[model samples]
Target: MEGFRLWPGALDAEAQSQLVQAVFGALGTAPLYRPQTPGGRPFSVQMSNLGPLGWVSDRGGYRYQPTHPVTGQAWPAIPQMLLDLWAATVGGKRAPDACLVNLYRDGAKMGLHQDRDEADLTAPVLSISLGDAAQFRIADGEGRTRTLRLTSGDVCALTGSARLARHGIDRVLEGSSRLIPGGGRLNLTLRIAR
Candidate 1:
C-alpha cells in the first residue's frame, strides 16, 4: 500500500467510452483468445495485448512476444489515450512496452501473483478498469491483503515498493455497469516489459 496509487474515475464517462472503442478497434486486429497456463489449464479470462510486446502463456511457459499467439500478426499499437495516461501518472523517459488486456465475464477471476516477468521491476504497472467492477486484491509486506472495488473509469497503479507485490482479481461484480455491450469487465494493464 505504500506505493499504490488510486485515482478514482481517472477517466470521465466520455473518456471511458472512447477508450473502450479504441480497445475494441485494436482487438479487431488481434482478437482476444483464452490463454492457457504452463500446465495446460485454461485461464478463465480472455486476453490480448497492445504495443510492441504481448504477454503470453502456453505449454512452453509465460513470456512476451511480438506477435499474436493465434493470429500470428504483430500486435496493434498502444492506444494514444493510454500513452497519455501513463505519461501523466507514471512519468518516465520510456513508455510502457506492453498493455495486457483482459476480459472477465461469468465469474472469471485471477489468482494472486507477482508481475515479475518484465525485465524492469522498477517501473510501475498501471491498470485501467472498465465495464463491471471487480474486487481487486493486493498483498502488503506484512502478509496482509487489501481489497478494493475497481469500477469503470477507475485507474490504479503499483509503483515503487509495490510494483512487484502480489495482486489479482478475486471476482467480478456482475451487472454493475453497462459499458461492455454484453456483461463483462475489461482490465488494461500497462507495463514496461523491457
Candidate 2:
C-alpha cells in the first residue's frame, strides 16, 4: 500500500445511508447494466454512473461517454457528498468529471486491470466502498499483489505511482453489512476522465 491511501470509516452510518440514497436516485435515470468485455464475456458486476461522463464497457471496448449507453441521456450530476469527498481527500482545484458506480452482488468479482483510460493519469482515483466488504487486490506491474478487506464506509485512493496499478475486487463477503437493501456492494470511483 505504498502509493495507495486507505481511510477506514470515512463515512459514518448516517452519511453512508445518505450516499446510498443518492446512488439510488441516480440509478432511476441511468439504470445499471451488465457490461461485456471486449471479447464478449459479460462482467459480473452491473454498472452505472453519475457526473458528466460515465465509464462503460461492451464488446466494442471500454471507454467513457457523456450519455448513458442504455438511455442515451446525459448522466446525472455527481452527488454533492462525493464531490465534497473528492475535494477533501484528493485536494485539488479540478473536480472529477466521471464517477463510475459499480454494483457487485454475491460471486461478482472484477478481474485485475489497470485504469488508464483517463486523459490525466496524474489524477488519483478515489474509490468509496459501501455495503458489504470486498477483498480488494492491488499489485504492481511485476504482479506482486496484496489483498485488503474493504468494508462499508471505507475509502481508498490510488494516486501518483499507483494511479495505473493493477487492481480488482476478488470477491465480496456476502451478508457482511446491511447497508444495501437487497444485499450487495457498491463501489463509487471518482476519476478525472477528460
Write down the TM-score of every candidate: 0.98, 0.98
lDDT of 2: 0.93
Clashing pairs in 1: none
Candidate 1: deviation at residue 47, Å? 0.2
Q: Alpha-carbon error at 4 in model 1, in Å?
A: 0.7
Q: What lDDT is reached at residue 37 by model 1? A: 98
lDDT of 1 by residue, 81-132 (tens): 9999999998889999999999999999999999998998899999999999
Candidate 2 residue-wise lDDT, 69-174, digit = tens: 8989999999889999998898787999999999999689899999999998998999999999999999976889999999999999999889889999999999
TM-score of the candidate numbered 2? 0.98
lDDT of each: 0.95, 0.93
Q: How accurate locally is residue 185 in candidate 2, as Cα lDDT from 0 to 100?
A: 98
After the best TM-score superposition of candidate 1, give how far the Cα of residue 44 lies from its true spot, in angstroms.
Answer: 0.3
Worst 10 residues of 1 by lDDT: 175-184
